[model samples]
Target: MATQLPVINLMGPTASGKTALACELYARGNYELISVDSALVYQDMDIGTAKPTKEEQQLYPHHLIDIITPLEVYSAAEFVTDATALIDQIHARGKTPILVGGTMLYFKALLEGLSDHLPSADIHVRADIEQQAAEQGWESVYAELQRVDPQAAIKFKPSDKQRIIRALEVYRLTGEPITQLQAKQVKNQPYSYAFQNYALLPDRAELHARIELRLQKMWKIGFLNEVEFLMEKYDLNDNLPAARSVGYRQALDFLQKSDRSLKNKAVMEEKSLFATRQLAKRQYTWLRSLQQTHQFNVYLSIEQAQEDLRNLYG
Candidate 1:
């Protein structure tokens, strides 16, 4: 039997230093990076997504960034296909593939494979849900989801419009709960490598502070201008996946405001911070469910993680 190639997965919440650590590992080893972030896939979304700079890309050479425009949809199935091919190509070149990002759904799809029984996305159904959310607040939709699929409702917040919309869409299309569908057996595994999964979970308070500071830095670095440019270039709205990203959504809302006051900026910043923290909370929930994975505090245990990776691969 041939030796199975190894793949490394570095997962964490937003602003948990996964990108910096992935760059460090890329420098230290013969590793090819495949970004697992959903937001980084879109072009012209640099500042709000915290995308690696041109200099960083030249130095570390991350793959799967800037592959599509903000208007296009990139699904988990596509990620599984692309990432599997990259892993194979990297292994053929005698290099380990390092998959790094905070998108836990991508990680799950890559690792466990996706269920085949679910229905495809219905744009009309989704549009109707969005319309309902627009007329009656997202809280109303969330309450409906709770009534329809309490199991899925327990996992989502009333403010998580994207996920709430998705769950309800699934329910409306298939007349079944998404959580129940997901419980079914996976259809197939796309990759053959054994995964060495590692999660970076920093302290809660410290991570929240980092999230706020990062949002502030994004504001200083023309993040609003970037969103404005995208809005002008593409027919983007709240429904698009790119605009639905944590910081981008809040930034778009702020830009559309007729008030445009300092208070609005302050409120946008606070909302962005709160949304990021909620994202981190959801990521923590996902990370806890991952099995056979090493956990580290990226702030405090980076050196130890580096040493372990060096010893394991060397």
Candidate 2:
């Protein structure tokens, strides 16, 4: 018998007001929030990751928020291990676990195990590949992967060197063609325990507008200063994992320029806003894919979400 209760996932594009709706639902249900976001695990990345403030979090207890250090990297595989344990612990205490966030990989990993598709990256091999990508343009490098893993290469654009390198790295590290290991899930899990999900999905224009407004808010909240502090203290240059994160990339561009000319505030605002919208587009794509298998409903109104939660709990 399955001992765990069904999880209610609240996921959508960034700046979709997931946290606010979650807070409202937490009030009506015997639930604990288990964040599935990749970025929210770190401390001091609060605003860029769209993390709930101390006051908002005080509205309800949260798990997996500050569990990772800024210097260390977290992976979807490890997140699943930790989250499964957290879910079991929460269920044992009689509170349902509400898995929330836009991280589709975390949700996929939790629902189904990591696709054995790719081999783990060997640091030395990856270092060599990164060097190769920089020295010789990514076209030559991806050409190399196209020879071995054409199927994977077909999906990645030539300019997306990061993913190209990952594919080539997998082949070099493990003699297995990385694409060969992709597996289909073996089970259609029955819902024996109570579970429900909601996503606050605004139209594309509204979502884009909200994303733009959010960037302005983050800029005002000292996002540039936070990136500067990381560069100065943590040696977090352009190549670090955290530096490659969404808003941080544009912020780094502002910090590292020689002329120091782009700090017009408006430029940073535009770049941050644009990058955030791009990130949301990718997130929306992932969430739509998951909704096919998971039974999450889209909520246009917070009132409907709250009413459903109250009825579920009572």
lDDT of 2 by residue, 133-239 (tens): 78987778989988999888888898777678778877887765567755433333343444465776677888887788887788788887888877777777665
Q: Can you give the TM-score per candidate against the true fold?
A: 0.89, 0.88
> Residue 56 of candidate 2: its Cα lDDT?
79
CA deviation > 4 Å runs, candidate 2:
1-4, 116-127, 184-195, 262-265, 301-314
- The total number of steric clashes, by the backbone 3 Å criterion, in model 1 comes to 0
lDDT, candidate 1, equals 0.84
| TM-score of model 1 (CA atoms) | 0.89
